[model samples]
Target: MSDSIDSPIIIDLPYEEGGKKYDEDIFARALQTETHQKTGQVESSNVTEYHLRILLHYPAVYVIHAEESHSQRSEPEYCVYVGETNDISQRTYEHLYNDPQNRDDWRLFNNHGNMSQYVITHPYFNKSLTLDIENQLMLYMSSVDHVSLPVNKRVNPQRDYYTHDRFKRIFSDIWLDLHRKNPSLFPAEGIILDSALFKASPFHKLSDEQLEAENIILSEIFAALHLESPDQIATDKTNPADSHLILVQGAAGTGKTVLLSHLFYRLLTQTLPEEDAPLIHSPASAWKSDDKHQDGDHASQRNLIPKEDISAYILVNHDEQIHVYNQIATKLGLQNRSGTVVLKPTEFLNRHSRKNDRHRALLNEPIDKADVLLVDEAHLLLTQGNRAYSGKSQLFDLLNRAKVVVAVFDPNQILQSSQRLSPKIQKLLSPADDSAANPSNNGNDDEPSRIQLDDYNNAKPLTVDVSHIRLQQQFRIDASPEVIAWLDAFTDEGIIGELPADCHEHAWHADDSVDTRSKPYDIRVFDSPVDLFDAIKKKAEIKADGCDGKGLSRLLATYDWEYTSKHKNANDPSGHWNVELHQDGTGTWRMGLGGGDGTDNTSHDRCFCQPWNYQLTDPHSHRKGLNKDQAWAEKPYTINEVGSTYTIQGFDLNYAGVIIGPSVQYQDGKVMFHPENSKNKNATNSRKDLGDFAEENLKDELNVLLKRGVHGLYLFAVNPQLQQRLMDVYEASKND
Candidate 1:
């Protein structure tokens, strides 16, 4: 067991007294005498003033010293003072009885009674000295009380009256005894005795077990501490001579959020010179106090600005993820009174609004007035263009003001239609700009220049780059390793070694009905827009009976299937598929509707009309509108009929039935999935080629969709050729 101090212990003493002079020799001899009485030591002459004070203040020790000194008038004065006391009253009584003899020796005394009075006055001349001595005495008495046992046990006391050496011994004993009684109570095993005892003890160093535990904790702290801002990183890397930018890529479940939070903590806690400290605005600064000025005016007054600035560990994401990040920040104790801000696309537009002159005015102000910027999901950034001015995205504008910028993005998940890096951002991340020299430019001035903007105009700034570290090892899947492996082998086909055998054996299983020709693992696809409507209605009915436990009529049908189908089909086929599939996959389908004409239009024209009826046309307006009447002339569409791709991306059913509508695939080879036909014709082609890209793209999407089940896949093809191609791919990949 090693001896180290386990917990903090404080000792307070009275202030020191001055004025009286003493003979060093006599003081030394008196200390030796006290030491001999307490610890049988003859080496008291070697003791320091500090040790002498401790001995004198010890509860059971005392020191008496006599001294003589010349006054300013050249008169010799003699004085004597007692430096310790066991009983105050008894000591004073003794001093009174001996005062007469001491006074008779003084020539200044007029008479014996006067001499005694003068002698006593010499000792108590300074009331401050007396107070100090009293305070010291009280301090030692308190120490005795602290370590003392109960009053009843004082008589049979565990130890004798306190001595300097005895106090040291007992303190060590008590600390060790506590450890022996409850070892686990200490943070680490073993105990740290008092410093004095630690020096004396042979076992003062850490044990092997203790050292190992200390190393573990130290490692965790070090890892947590290394996270810093780009500026700080630059300073650390000794690269302050050049400006640089860094990008961090990480996937979900990685410690990106935790790392960012740690960085913020470090930035806030960093010690900066008084003048150089970063100016930060706190939530309190934005709030007004109720207190009025002395003039009794009604004007609002700002609260006192705290000397310490309150900064945040901000987590930036789309509006949908804001609630989740806010909850995480709150859990980590980083949330402040100002609350979290979710920077939506519209908010960005509002900040740089063309129509709002006031907003434009605000944009012209100095940018450094804000704190550092941290962007998560950086890949979602997009550029803007207008007839008046070529514009950069809101994210680029924010980067100009921040001294340190930290961004996290996964290149694989860039979902925006225009998913190309802006020139400024590209320069920041990868400085070598080769786009200008490309032969395809043909000296055309109409083409946008790919020049990097020197936005900050700073002499030098720091940049730090970090790669994504795997955190998948920590996720424990509660399924058979074999089953999980089989699913991963198919869905993540090219990405090998992802699923272990343990994951596949415990996976859940489900089978499909043979009549539907749908394998248990196959995703159910609707035959046509009308068939999709019917299938959804049937599912809703089943859900109402089995899960919702309510009559089908009770469930509200917010959107008319026919109207939604027509409106969705109105878009270019690729755009339509992208909106439906991505929205449904990411569980953000609601955002797609919340943003556009989906919210506007007359009551009848709105896709989601009121009431629970899923009919394609209003019964009351059956004969009112000619076009609407013709559309719904055949039969009423019910909730059981309509389905959207968004509702079933990651899900799998026992049987899958797909309907390839003519809008997507035509016999004349007018394929909507062709890369050349896409909105951005020049975009890089994925594994799927031009003409049949839609069907091929659906292969992977459907793979992700179907493998969610345990047994098999059931796929239906409305277009025989497209269906045959999909089946061929699936069958070929199965053996591989």
Candidate 2:
């Protein structure tokens, strides 16, 4: 193994060769066992010096799976396992002979005849790099539709390494090779990358900002909980606050969900950094770069971690996103062990909060406490009572129960009045700034702005030390800075400005269509809703770069059309709640196409209409098998339907076809929000005591709709004024 050998070596183990698990001499033995190339005679040989030299002799990572020949599946599915080892030969022998005596999972590979393994070895593979690769494989394989269940659960996601920069390219090359060998077992990297579980997996490497945030947050948690600290970490100073609330404020697609997922996994799997700790007990992943060995073999040193009972949970409000987080929890063996790690805000409230709790627990009073509570989409937390949750405020209730509440918050994403943060609380989450630019508290990535609130939500009073941390980078909407500025201007300032001269823009004509020709992004505006839908269908059929199958494209809209999770009435027995729009013969804008004057949006009209999401049946539904819950955009059937903020919040689309409904209109000077035109009671409903947030809520609705596309954004406005304004902007940009 040498640095010159940059490419990964993929070795496939045959099912069996005379009761042996692997063909160490694969190329030579295959030619001998089946037919000699020179002699046309059947023979076998188990000797090859060249194959032996590279056959898992060095450090490597490996994956093995079993496929039943008589299994009742349209496509192949397998029970997969991913592992890493320094001595691959010994590890293989142990799995086949010894490990089966203790573990049932290994027994499958031991006895099953249809088992095959693709061993991955590289010259740069070391203890930490191989472990990280193994963890990534576990995460990716578990999310694959073809993988039924996983046998290996050792999730060791390493921190920065000497060759960490090369990990992404190396792992991709290895995966591509494996896919070529068994396309069914190993789906294309694109399909896996687009999955919700993969997006939320803990194995995702952190950006510099994310890494800084992670370290600071972890330090905060340790300080708050008074956990044992190593010598290098400062722990002499202690804050006497009863509870700590860390507010992670960022716009959409700033890696908030992934950051929370990674933290949750760390809280469950890790202890604290120590010297000479074994694999599962060490925080060596977070070791400093200065501590690395001169030869880049720092992993050889064993640093153990102290074990602690750090009860942690991550709560989200959405129905589909909960499924993604829960699936990640299950695959990594983080749930159903001691207690659940992923939960809804309401379920957690009921389970943790005492029914008799009317006042907050007094200082130093006996209170039920959890180590850490991570809240994703904290803006979606209920600010008022509902039938489902009787609490006055979900955020306040969570703070009363947990030692530290780390919530991913963005006031702009607060969709409904029930989830809106009042002016009083606004001061606490205010002044969101880039952590990278304004580092505070001894020059770490923590925000300089901090507010100490003594009493929060009088109904459940508690002392909370609130801090705001902002993530400014845009991870979604793969467009230029000018493109992002244009979108922000429209949503935040209500101005549709011209695009940049070099903006990554594309328009589809009969001759020009979507393809995977390595474009940075594609932004287009359609005058007709039908044309937008057609282009979306075309984009869905075309794969993006590094993908093997069709891309993910969905029709989205503002909350203008009427829709519900239930059936409308006996007249519409099909329960196909649709977003219908058309012209009233004079080409005047008309909604709900067929029932004459277009007053009722749910009229029985099929023309110029498509069902809202969760309304249509996709012939390819069986192939997707959405596990009874999926992100609205992830399903194949949803392409025939339209989605809104509820189903698509905290999600991304490869290409988004957003129908900007009439509720969002361009008025005298700028974008005007008309709640009267909206059918969403949540957005238009009168706030009981919290002031009117309709304008802000609808503004967020439009902002969210416009930002869903990662590779592209396709838009059409139902409002004539808004439509005309957008066309004007598009035309003005053409000259540049």
Candidate 3:
């Protein structure tokens, strides 16, 4: 896991003894006994048969090795082949030598007649499990320095774990046996553990409850899928009508994203290792054509469902989110998998819509298809697709087409007018009749509506009732209960009171009298933005020098800035910021201006304008380039000022320097918002009419900005009155 380019090679995989005793294992006997006992029990026989056949084949993982010298290193390296085969003798023969008819078919070894082979076999292995082992082996081999990469191209496998303890023990034994068989090649402590990867993986890191939620969702999808039969589908030539909609409701920091990541992986790959067993009978193996045409054709004529019968896609709305998702997909190897695409919602809609002429030709025929669709930040689904989607609402369109739709919904996160759900969808989400599904209990105003059983059951054949799951636990902020309670009250009522009695003592507190050094969370109220900027810089430098545990900090602010409608060419004699601070006293400062003339830009000293976070127009070439976010992440500094909701949403920071702009102010003992003062047309336009959507979104944005800081939240306000009000609220909450 270390970021070492040339670490010494350390292998601990021993050669052979105690490796292939799979036939005698208790797991093998238990599977046989269970399969026989369940012969007449049709309800459980399918699952039992799956386990029985997997244990019977007794799969083996083998390695083919050949020594070679490369120019990159002084020492010779080995081109090692690691694979699993049910028939090791035949498979190895084919790999080392050639077929009687086609010599190229056996060219895996290439001119290297001299080779050594090693193997570890197990009785209870499936396609999913074998792929997992091969992937881990590749990762380990790739980690070694001066070692030629493994000859196999591993397909990243989902960590489809066994639910049975016996099966778990069998897999563990195989792993240990392999290490013992080749100690010089497989290091004992070298490769990272799957559990470790699960923790660090963007797709994992969920609580037990969240894991349960994932299982429930999968079970529901499986239930719907089970309703379709191959014979029926082939005859009807119609997409199945058993789709279901699952609504996941959670607020900003409630780990909806983490859940979505887990869902994306689990859905695309098999979830349980034993679920798809009997490799010989699997549709994939059956479909492999060879010179034994009759034999291959006979094998392929089975009633098994192809893996592609179900497909999963993870969809977002923004390009930045797509970039982040694509990176994660590549890391997890999901990017290589067929039927799994991570893209923006618009792209997804366009690809699936029949309206796109190019798509019809590319895909052979236009048909709306997707077994499962996971929509992250569902609140961001556009009510209008900007004419690209032919004006269809993304949510309803997806629900109608996909068999299983899972959405992470947060009403407060809807910042644009285009993202509003229709009235019918809204009613389904939040029924005006259900009292229990009210705002007070769920922490969000809109909750999924309670559907009467008859409503869906009596409706059209394909219609589905929406199921809602609300997640309440907060994971992003490490604050006391009182602090969270205070934040909630502040957002809800624009004020705060004495700290709640149940609140625990933590790093966060706001009394000026308290010792600042003792509190990890330094809640500060600064009158001047310049001083706040200096303090954030000092912290960043300390962090950069390895003095602070909580990593990098960044500056953030309210969208009281006008994102200029006038497009300025990067070559324009005068460079202008797409986002200009629209406050009365604020001056226009362009990013990358470089202290020009040092006159009108006192603001430059306080803001380190980073153009990478937002798109920039190159004036000289009239081209758009230089992603500020990519650049800033590589070389982060507190002074590299850049952040807006678009860039910072769904991301976490160590400390946040917040500047409350003039758009929001303290007036007549209440917080007031002036949309005219804000140039963010989206926020301003989103506020007009229609209840508290705008108000809630604005508060949510600030709440998100404030809670981003893991260790501290530094504050500055354009309006002095609002600054004093916040300080007063913080102080009142800390009083005994």
Candidate 4:
């Protein structure tokens, strides 16, 4: 409680070689006062006294950073460590001298020869607030393009505290002030907030459900990995095929990916006491946690004697999503002397399994097993043989190469025949049977149930264990329960019921809300594709006031148009495949190719037309835009192109203009889905094993397309009946 609260303080100090011993000089300067006192008299004022006491006793957060990439021909990569402590001098001393002896990150910061640290403080600093601040710093640094590695790995997001309401403004203020000091190190806050990596960062504040799921995952991992000490157990001799699976079930935008990312970071932060190697058995004598290594204590000194590094891998199937994961893994230093840590399932399988397994597993040689494998978008994992993979099941193949496999599965997101979950597997994943034979899977995720698999080669009786945890909240849509329910009904069950009264209400901007400045979540239906795209661009334009604009809007559609990958269309010589709609409200369905110049007849006004994904020339061909690695949707020029489930599946947009193609239509009393209308073979094709899944596949594609918008979803249906129905619903809701 100073007389007036001042802004956060930021000062960068050099860690010089052969300099004076470290001291608390930053706070010492803050404590300096121009008090005119007699030689023996001591000054006393409540304001000064209060400031002095808090400065001496209160908590503060700090960041230490040094260049990691030292190549003369390349750019500098800063390795950053974020932390909070009550005693700055003691903590810095511990990190500088003692911590370097244990952790490699600390050693680099200590011996890099050129190092600088930023010590931050504020009048409102407390244990909780400082810890949250430190976590937020980690979240941002993990996504910053220039920061190559994050030294801090622990998750310390706190619940509501005394000053919880001020956290966002305070953190942004601190970051902005710091940005003024160093632009490269601390870029614009808005730019960072708009990144995919930032949205999926591990340091974010988890919902109660996410936090609960994280705790459950961690406990399961500990229980599985802590079965015995490293030396006592025969891990090398044990079979890797007996690995367990933790299946997290949730629909799209339900925060499944965030929970998975948190688990991935947390699992890597753990350590098993393995002088020889890691073990799955519990031995109390040697087991210890390396979670708090950033607490500035050498492992040995603090009895955290972890000799073996925990083997962990995070895999994904989607290209865009895997890109995001690899960036995060690289920035968090989530790797070792071995190759990459984040990889595709095929890469993981190919690397760990014997090459003969594409034909057969190498005889006698053991599988190169990892301690844990975390799979995101597991629904996309192929179940049958393909060109790159010859396995029976990717999930089973993953289990064969690791001690544990944790998968995030959403049966609804399965968009291909190859990835289709068979009836048997679906039954195993989300058990609908509550019989005595499968009582454990009675809709309870507290304990995992067992799944029997016909052994890899039918050589032995092998069964894999499976667990199911459900996440029900929709995190992507910034709307109320009624709004979300309407979306779910419209997409999931295909029931175009009356829109909710508050379907357009902004949940964050209610009269009784904390942040009432955000714009409402827009839900509209447009008659013209041109109008829909125009509205999306209108929303995409940067707003002057509080619309929470990230300046990204995209036009998406159902898989109805023919789009060949990388093939230049001969009809339209622009070298781009276009999704065309003529001025008469007719689309590719009527014209027999959306882009045939509308040559059939009538006037070709080109009402609405845009290139499909990967067809546009490089918008950042001159140089890397923003000097950072970006996903397909993050690029500035992608706005001109239409995205599909492949490029934009695991991303978010400010607003989405989705054109419901001929695949989805409405009739007298119900909605109809036409599989034959869609050109996406992945959705419309049939499998030799599982006959016809076209209906569900197309539905899932529409589901993903409609849910991409965070603040809004505008629609234009190619089918007239569907279009009229949607418009009628909008008009009815408006007049009411």
Candidate 5:
């Protein structure tokens, strides 16, 4: 079955020189009565209701043609305005003769010009259903061969679809009827499929699995909206919201961000029927003074509350992630809408926080103001209150405000202890009945300590269900199944010392020769950290120069070295010294730290310093052979080593050179972490407290750093013993 239906009516528009022309008058009750009302007679309240019923008798679409008053005027063009209105008589009246100061100012209506309109109605017509059909017609007209497209500024609808498929089919039939009347004004069915509006749609080109996921999610949203009533106002004193909590779990690169971006895009474009328009325009009392509808309008008064088209907001913790989402919204033309917003979780809370005294007066909104909240990287949500976040918990705050909350979850992605959720949310995110508590096949030999969500206050009520959906397919990297299994096990399971014989046979064998040219992904181990660094630099340079059709090759390491930037004069920005790298020379080549402001007789070579990834693009480049002036602006990968998850987290790269610093070493045939050598404060959390949160956090950090590479991963161990142990483990797995 085709998705779009062709218009049945064919017409050679006036401009079609020799072509046959079909003419049909699409008269509606509203436009028919407009002539009688032009005498400037005031309508009684009862009579107004009669006209309102006639205009809104059925869900219908109306097209207003702006025609020239003079017959000798240049040949008329189909520069029409397409819209959907339940109360067409009232809506068109306002368009034609409403207050000249604030109403629509179509020049054709301003002059003594004649106007005509076409109406398409259906038996199953409702405001939302007609709006959906109206938008489709607009898209179709814009893509066809016309002298001028409809005067619609944005033809893309703000929604993916209406609530039900039955209504959708009815809308399709309405399109067919319109097309039959004026086939020349519409594109063929195939043209509709390839239309620019369709191409730019967020739901475009989705895989079957992704489409299914979208359908399930949309169905849930539809169900939730159906349960909402017109009388329940979010501005009311009593809270009537029945919010649902949905949990979707996926590891890095599982396309969570993409899905959320599209969801927000479709939501922003959703058109509200006339009755629901006031929901977004301030509180109901505030709209009573609206200049355009100040005449005790019955149609406007009835729409003070919305039944659907509720507002949605997206909250993300990471600046990098939020920036990506903002760019996606802008691409879909959804950034300017007031109903949707993409902001940091902290910023969102601060904006809504009663603490902001200035905004509190007018915006003292109920907790349930937001209808839908989409949280990306929800594992990063904070649990405890701090100076930055005054709220008890972000998860709890979001659930309090939204009727439907969908969050992407990954327990492994939790970076710190402070970024935890409440006990109720944790229980909701726990593995379900069919889920495995642990899997030996993927890698972890032992389970980490279970996260403690029960430590939260028990007084808060928990009313929402924690439905779970897990995405298992990995999309970031292309590698053999054995390699994938091996990498996961190696990262999660403590695989530093001699591996068990059974583990070796399961993942490796001597016959597994690496064929880089034919392999989907490549992995290699280097004896020297410098050699690995050089390979990564070469790949980065080649990719940057477009010699290899790729980019994002980088060098990453454990946070073992201290990063310092000292300036000679506090006031002089140019007096800043190069970023310095230090610690036993175990990591990589670096400028000796003895130089002071270029006065000391010490070698002032290059050193590593963490660059601000979020604030600046191409920050203090690492390219080599730069003159003193050019050195500071080189490519980031040109630098020898990049450390810390702050720079690489939530990012992807083609290849990564990983340096296992001195912090990780083989002692007594077991891998040991010396917390004293680490520079990261977060990493040192394991020092005084061993076999606890800090230790697991360090492990998770290392796993994340190594997995940053998408196409290839190369390892170089700074500690000779650890390096030798790794080689031994790989060698033992070579049983053919």
Candidate 6:
């Protein structure tokens, strides 16, 4: 054949002619046939040049074409729909079997369903490509259907109803109904609606009447439930008359904190005196009000009310969260001797001194008069201890006394076995009782029953009986419609959308040495602790350079090292890392404070140590010399603080490098195989037992280490075996 003839001829065939010539058989054969180039599949007769262009440019697109013949006496036997998908097989299954969400469309073609034929075009063949293909396919199909209408004819009323705006409005209405009637069925406590569905709906622009109606309806709903309106709950307002416990649940970035702040403001300002009166009735009075104490001075002096009048807003969490909140409060001028009280369980206990028994007794008295109690991380508050002595009753007692309490919880981040509470708590927070325990239970009566509140005889229960509200809007990023849709799909499908659009451009430049230029999204992984140490040193260097060698402020180095303790041979080389010392050799590790004299004579052992002067080794003691006692052994194991990841959770740093020591592993489908295990296995055997003793330690280690970074995270697993385990977790989480 001539070169000109060999080149496939491009034709602008009519839809009918194209359909007749390229049936299912021809299309299938073409897809399977070997092409001349051996790289590309043979061109199918059913696919058009337009579709081919789309496929070639956008490898994620799938093109489907069909034709049907209509008899004058009956309806058409076939209807075609074009769509793209990451998984062709799944999309095909849904269209052919699983009815599309819009039942009206399905009903229109139900009579001719048997005559329908389906063809799928695969974009990518990798396992990861499945979801992407399916998503793209859905988008393409919807888009094609949108533009396929006859231009000259009047628009279909049904089509108008399915418009992006209309879809969003309908979905919003459905969500509102579901949220009102069956609130607990939705995840994230229904605070998160389908962003895509919302965009497709027509409810975004509420008319003045609609807005007023919505507010009134919402107010009535809250009123009927004897709960504060969502607006009132979010604003910083206090209802001295109504003592109801409010549960505000939602994912991050849903204005929870902002709403809480507003509520605080309302609570603070609403109680101001209505008017200020002068001491004297008139100017003619010879003896006027004490002019020395002018209104301006009075106003200035009385700007802040007495601590007793202010509602006690308590934010509870583990030690770390409390520490972070304290720091934030201090910076925001919200902290005062009585206005803000920061207390850990140990700190609360320590306040009871043996010498000041009377003060200690008063300190432990019930907080029955507290006006308001806000628990920021309520999930962390529920965790139990091994014994009653270490239990959280102190915190529980305080919570029970408050007139109003607000809490936030994320079920997915449950960190401890004890943290998991009874269904009673879940029921109280959930909007409805149906499916509150398990939506997948199929209403099985034979299933094990839940423990009733009455079962706990010794303890007085803390009941949160008020109505619930869920915040659905996310204001974290300025995302495009496409990006929002993609995120929504990921959340719906239970897939981890790594490199989400918010973090898309967060990579660091390979040549950029300055830490200031580094992005937060960069994934930094190292095989050894030395590498992590080097990364930290680099950041320190950048800080030093930025400060013109004046030395960085608030920069500290903390490690799991014991030689740095205050009680250790003060003469030992690494004795500057400890924060406190008791008569015993044990001491606490100070997370911040390092850099000191080369001889290590600093009063505060935890003072900052220069990088060049610091050494990761123990030196032989001289006077009162190296105590050979096992407790005082100068061995490496005794020198470093082992497994202290919990000390730094809920904290942020300019940069952080986590070094995964060798004493960790994953074996026999369980995370174990550690030397510590061999010595501690006798402690417990049950999953809960092991989890209580080990899992929290490991998770705390990871959580604290991960959270330390404000701009960057550098992870280094010292052991290759442990590195692999960490990698497996990262990969598995990504897949999820």
lDDT of 5 by residue, 403-466 (tens): 7788877777766656744455565557544253222122111221222222223324435544
Cα shift from native, residue 249, model 3 (Å): 1.1
Query: lDDT of each structure?
Result: 0.29, 0.69, 0.53, 0.70, 0.50, 0.34
Q: What 10-residue stretch in candidate 1 is worst by lDDT?
A: 148-157
Candidate 1: tens digits of C-alpha lDDT, residues 1-736: 0111221111111111132333344344544554465457564233435444432332321212122342332322222122324332233333434333444422222121211110011111122332223222222221110111010000000112223222222333333333343232211111111011111111122223222222222222222223334545655744321111224443332333334433343333322222222222221122221211111121224322231342323444344334334433332223432244324333433443334453442332333222344555566554433232234443444443333345555443343334345444555454233342221222111222232444432312223322121222111112343534544553344222222223132222222211212112222332222333344344334321110021121111111122333244454332232211112222221212232423432222222212112223444453422212111101234232322222322122222223332222223322233333223221223322112233333323333333322232233333344444444545554555
TM-score of each: 0.33, 0.81, 0.60, 0.85, 0.55, 0.39
Candidate 3 lowest-lDDT run of ten: 1-10
Model 4 TM-score on a 0 to 1 scale: 0.85
Models, CA RMSD each = 27.8, 6.7, 14.0, 6.1, 16.5, 26.5
Clashes of 3: 18
Per-residue lDDT tens digits for candidate 6, residues 1-736, read: 2321212211111122221333333433333442323336554444434334322333232323233443431222223333334433344444444443444443343344333332222222222232233332222222221111110010001111212322222223323332343232221211122111211111123323222222322232223222333554665354323334555554433444434433332233322211122221111111111112111122222222233354545465565445434433332224443225444433432332222443342322334344555565565554445432244433344444455555555443344445555455556445554332221232212222222222121445444335344454533322333344433432233232333322344322232122223232333555434344555666644431221111111122222223322254354364443322111122222222322322222543323223211223444433232212211111222223222333333323345555544434444433342434212221112245224333433333333344434444556453455456555545554555
The true-versus-predicted C-alpha distance at residue 549 of model 2, in Å, is 8.0
Of 2 and 4, the candidate ahead on TM-score is 4
Error (Å) of candidate 3 at residue 29 is 39
For lDDT, candidate 1 versus 4, the one ahead is 4
How does model 5 fare in lDDT?
0.50
The TM-score obtained by model 5 is 0.55
